[model samples]
Target: MLENLLPPLNDHNLPYPDTIHPIVVHFVIAMVLFAVFCDGVGYFSRNSKLYEVSWWNLFFATISIFVAVMFGQIEAGLALAYPASESTLNLHTILGWSLSGIIAAITAWRYVLRLRDPKTLPIGFIVVGVVLTVLVCFQVYLGDELVWVYGLHTVPVVEALKEGVL
Candidate 1:
């Protein structure tokens, strides 16, 4: 039934069209970075506006990360990843899931803080943001490795997989 309803899979093995994970992941990344930026600037500048912006960004990021992860899980399953890329793919998958939960918890914490005082942010929140940023950077590196170094679903790689070229 699903096979009949779905369109032809692309070279990347996607049903509808081009890879959607990367596109959605970009939004998540931008939101996370910008939220951290707003938190930092809001803290230093004593600007409540930046805090509000940060809150919204984090809130949206929390929602967007789930979307990103959902598509990532789908696309990863279709990637036909070879043995060489398996370890990295596994790690990326773990990190992706972890980030989703972390973002949700952090957003909940931010909501509490916002409700308490929009004008001031705790140093602890800023510290946690730094940790989150590092994790994001590492995840991005792993994702880049998958696409560039491993070429998980690129044309040549997919062709190689089909031809048993590794």
Candidate 2:
């Protein structure tokens, strides 16, 4: 069968080179944080252009979050996480999924706000954006811990797991 000729999974637990989740997630994070910054500045400065920029950023972020989440799910499944990393991984997974939905909902709400007023944004929206940024930062911390502290899918970690050293 052709399946027998396929390459083995790498130390990263992927068929290809490296993890896609972190790459995608970083983009999503940038978009979200940048969008929030744009919203805050636009709201304070009464700058319509920044509001437009913020809206587009949020819209794109909403779309990108799904991609990020999909890759995160796939990579997490392949990670073969050990006990030390399990709790953090579980929380990250749960929060990642939750963030995808929340981002979508926030984008929808932003759409309504944009339609109602193109030149202005509500302070409440900016407040919510800040809160969302906080949550995103927390998610980032969890992800960082998984990679740096727990060493879930790194080469050494994978080798250790295979050799029963972990």
Candidate 3:
């Protein structure tokens, strides 16, 4: 009965065949990297204006990461995993959640710093941003492995699933 109300699952076996996770996650990734970049430039150039840009980027990223994680959890759960991809998928899922937490924590820290002194951002905080940037790069690699290497939810994989070959 509920099936009657819902749209048919598409090629990816999702109500919408296209994955929302990637679309949203890319934004999160971009915002995070850009925030870090802005912070780094602000630090090196001693440009207070870039700190404002960095703060806004981090603020938006904190909100967007949650959305990305929500879609990621849903899509990951729906993804068909073969033996080879299973472990990688598990790692990706764990790291995705970890990244979300890290982003939120960093944002909170930055918020505190902003409230304490808006005129200057500490070098220590900039270093932390660098660390966050590294983690984000690693996460991007894992996500790429899932989509590019493992082809999760791609056309061929979906076809194989339909044929009970995977």
For model 2, the local distance difference test gives 0.90
**Looking at candidate 1, what is the lDDT of residue 66?**
94
lDDT of 3 at 55: 88
Prediction 3 global C-alpha lDDT:
0.88
lDDT of 1 by residue, 1-166 (tens): 8679768777876786678899999999999999999999988888879998999999989999999999999989999798889999999999999999999999999999989988889999999999999999999999999999998778888888878887
Model 2 TM-score, all chains together: 0.95
Error of 3 at 74 (Å): 1.0
Query: Residue 64 deviation, candidate 3, in Å?
Result: 0.7
The 10-residue segment of model 2 with minimum total lDDT is 6-15
> Which parts of model 2 have CA positions greater than 4 angstroms off?
1-7
Predicted structure with the largest lDDT when compared to the true one = 1
Better of 1 and 2 by lDDT: 1
Better of 2 and 3 by TM-score: 2
In model 3, the clashing pairs are none
TM-score of each: 0.95, 0.95, 0.95
Each candidate: RMSD: 1.3, 1.5, 1.3
Residues 72-116 of candidate 2: C-alpha lDDT, one tens digit per residue: 888898897999899999999999999999999989999998899
Ranking by TM-score: 1, 2, 3
